[model samples]
Target: TGACLEKKRAHDREIHLHEQVEKNYARLQELEGQRDGLTYMIVHDLRTPLCSLISGLQTLPAMGELGADQCEVLEIALAGGETLLGMVNSLLDVEKMESGAMKLDYTLLDASELITCAISQVSDLVLAGDLTLVRALDSDLPFFEGDEDKLRRTLVNLLGNAIKFTPAGGTITAAAHAGEDKQSLIFSVSDTGEGIPEEDFERIFDKFGQVSSRQGGRLMSTGLGLTFCKLAVEAHGGKISASNAPGQGSTLSFNVPIKPVQTIAV
Candidate 1:
């Protein structure tokens, strides 16, 4: 009788502990949801004013001719504003993507043109950073049907990351080629920066994930860029990954199907 009573008490305690754990987990999820909602609202609100500021900056040159010094300063200001606006837009899109509220706008897109446009967008930044931009695109990349804007932004985000971590004189390469399957195309951005740690290969794509390195120091990122890239790529029925050789550099790559099995509207 004593042994049976003891066993019963132990079982009761175990059940109580399990219940407590479940309660704590639920509470944590609720808190995280609330935080995400607040963030989405704030970031969404920032878009309008940011657009107005960028518009005014754009019109400044057209308003009148400016001195060289003033023009250079204005250019820097506009660049900064545009960069900030991009980050804000990324935050909103990430939220929409996570919530399955975003839709993919499929279009007939030229792979080479997409690569060239993406490179052009960040050419100025690449030059300013004293980095060399290498284009390794295959001459015969086939035309694909996908969301052009999302794909372009994905490339830009990868290049931006490379530019941020890469030191002056480093080379950043944008490459694209037909996948062996011929049903997909592979695109990659590689940088000769302090390579990412093996442990961070997956985590770097997580929301708000940041990688710290001995040589380059902590990455200065809000960490949403790669998350957005991952979601965008996956939405097109594709996958993304990161890899690097020790002491060499890192590459972030993704593949897109020539035609998605299904156009996802989420």
Candidate 2:
């Protein structure tokens, strides 16, 4: 009788454990479904207004009745519109990638060419911010297989952050080097501006995490760029990190495997 009672108790415990597991699994599925629905709704709703705003702002320049000051204000408004559109597009692209919906075309991308185009895209902003841009691409760097558009966005985000944070007369430098044996390409973006404090270095890479108290404040950004960078790099199966320069500013570096990524298509 004693042995039978013990066996019964063990069976009851196993059944209770199975019931708890089922409950937790159901909760997880419900939460995931809610998250997916929210993302879809937000992205869908953003496009309509974004299109209207950009279209109306674009038409303003064609009207010649405005004064110089008015035209300048219009230009600023249009610029803000473009920035918003870009942000929305970026968010959607990130969602697609996260959902495994983005198809990446893997091709041998010329590092030099990619860097030049990405830099040109943001050259105006850097110049307007009074920051000097510099690039040093190792000629011997081997061609690597990756998605060109994604890499371009990654580089642009890095350079844009550098320009935005660095004060007047600061310098932003980008360097690329190919590993001799590991078949990896290492790229680093360094800025000669206010450096991030030691404690906030890792925190800044976290999603929606801001280093404002140490670097500046929330007035300048929405804090999404770095998070996007982190996600893009991970999608490419690469690692990224940030470190403070000895005297001033910070360096954000990441590497891509030089050889073809066999397991993943992108």
Candidate 3:
């Protein structure tokens, strides 16, 4: 009876691991962040040219009457090149943001615009996974002072994580509401997925903190992601947090000053 019970528990754990792994981001942001390394330098140097090459390849299909075989090869090249370029850029962003070296360009920007741009970027990914994307914008919200680019990046990361974590037919909602104090805005990204354990609410946001999906094997942790999100929000006199949602899934929310009193360094 004891042995049978243990076997049943092991089976249940395996099923849970499969679900978590399925929810993981397929975009593969697992780039090793090794600055001052030859590999990093090479990828750094290749980004610009690879981007240019991808662009050029994109134009060829439209500009010329190429054979089907030739067009297929071009398509493959474009896909592979873009993947490499994305990884290169991801590493750079993580390194710069983590080091607190990148300067922010502060502006009084419409939160609506920031939110829309981010949704647009991640919408295709959400759809590809057959997940529903929901948006809830606070009406007549006051304009906030912050870097549009950085804010958009933060939104993208949050939404991207949602898209990656939710399974087919699941819902991922991005919502915002103004603070009662009239000095801040609250933003949230919630998804229907394997919810976080109550104890991990704080640890997940720590740098390099990891979650394993299966035994003796590891699933890429969301630790680096929460780390980056926390830093980005805090850099603007804001605070970020994570918690389990009702029924299932996790909600990551952050509060930002409506008008950031601390000037963001250019």
Candidate 4:
């Protein structure tokens, strides 16, 4: 009877251990759900001011008293509006992704064409900063199946950050090529800007994490660009990473699988 009791106690202990692990897991899920809820609320709240600022800036240009000084202020206002709008959009996009609501509409796309269009969208900012933008896309790069919109957004965020952080005379380059195995497309955005600190490299991809050590404090950060890039790349079954370039800048790169899909005719 003593041996039987020992076995019963051992079984009870194992069951208790399993119960404890389950309880901890449940608690973790609860905490994560709460965090996501708070994030959604905060992102939703930002939309109001973002819209208001954008609208106010649109009205500023029409004000009758606009002089050179006023024009400068208006320009600043316009830039701020753009920044706020971008931040709100990034936050909402990430929140949607986290909630599993972001749907990827994959289509066969020419990588070179996509990069060209994305760069054009941000050409004004790059030119305004007097930074040279270059593209080194492979002419023979094959088409890949993916969500073009999200991929373009990820590239834009990377390029925008590159342009924003780089000095006026610095260079920003976007390059794409076939991966070593030719089964994936490897793309990178490099800028001759203030490099990222070694310790903050990974943290920079975390939500609300920004590179604060740069000369200009938060000069070009809403703190969501890299985070959004991480999410967007992962959503498309890709890998994204960042490292200090050989010289005076940072390089952000990602690899998306190059699976071909049948072309659908309209």
Model 3 lDDT tens row, 1-266: 99999999999999999887866643233433342355547767887888788889888868979998997898789768876775577566556666567777788888878888999988768878998888899888888888787678788878877776677999999988899898899989999977666666787777556654323445556635566677778888898888886767989899889877565432
TM-score of each: 0.92, 0.83, 0.73, 0.78
Better of 1 and 4 by lDDT: 1
After superposition, candidate 3 runs with Cα above 4 Å error: 1-43, 66-80, 203-209, 213-218, 223-226, 263-266
List the candidate numbers ranked by TM-score, top first: 1, 2, 4, 3
- Candidate 3 global lDDT: 0.77
TM-score of 4: 0.78
Predicted structure with the largest TM-score when compared to the true one: 1
The candidate that wins on lDDT is: 1
2 versus 4: better lDDT goes to: 4
* Model 2 CA lDDT for position 152: 83
For model 2, how does the per-residue alpha-carbon lDDT over 136-231 read when each residue is reduced to its tens digit?
888788788888888888889888888877889999998889866567888888898777667777777665566753534542342667777777
Which residue pairs show backbone clashes in model 2? none
Residue 5 of model 2: what lDDT?
100
Worst 10 residues of 1 by lDDT: 214-223
Model 3 clash pairs? none
Q: Write the per-residue lDDT of candidate 4 for residues 1-266, one digit (tens) a residue.
A: 99999999999999999999999999999999998889788889988987887787788667767899988988888887787788888888988887778778889989998899889989999989999999998889999988899899889988987987788999999999999999999999999987887877788788878666567555234388888888888877778988996676999999988873233210
For candidate 3, the TM-score is 0.73
3 against 4, candidate with superior lDDT:
4
Tens-digit per-residue lDDT, 22-115, candidate 1: 9999999999999999999999999999999999999998999999999999989998998899889999999999999999999999988998
Q: Sort by lDDT, best first: what order?
A: 1, 4, 2, 3
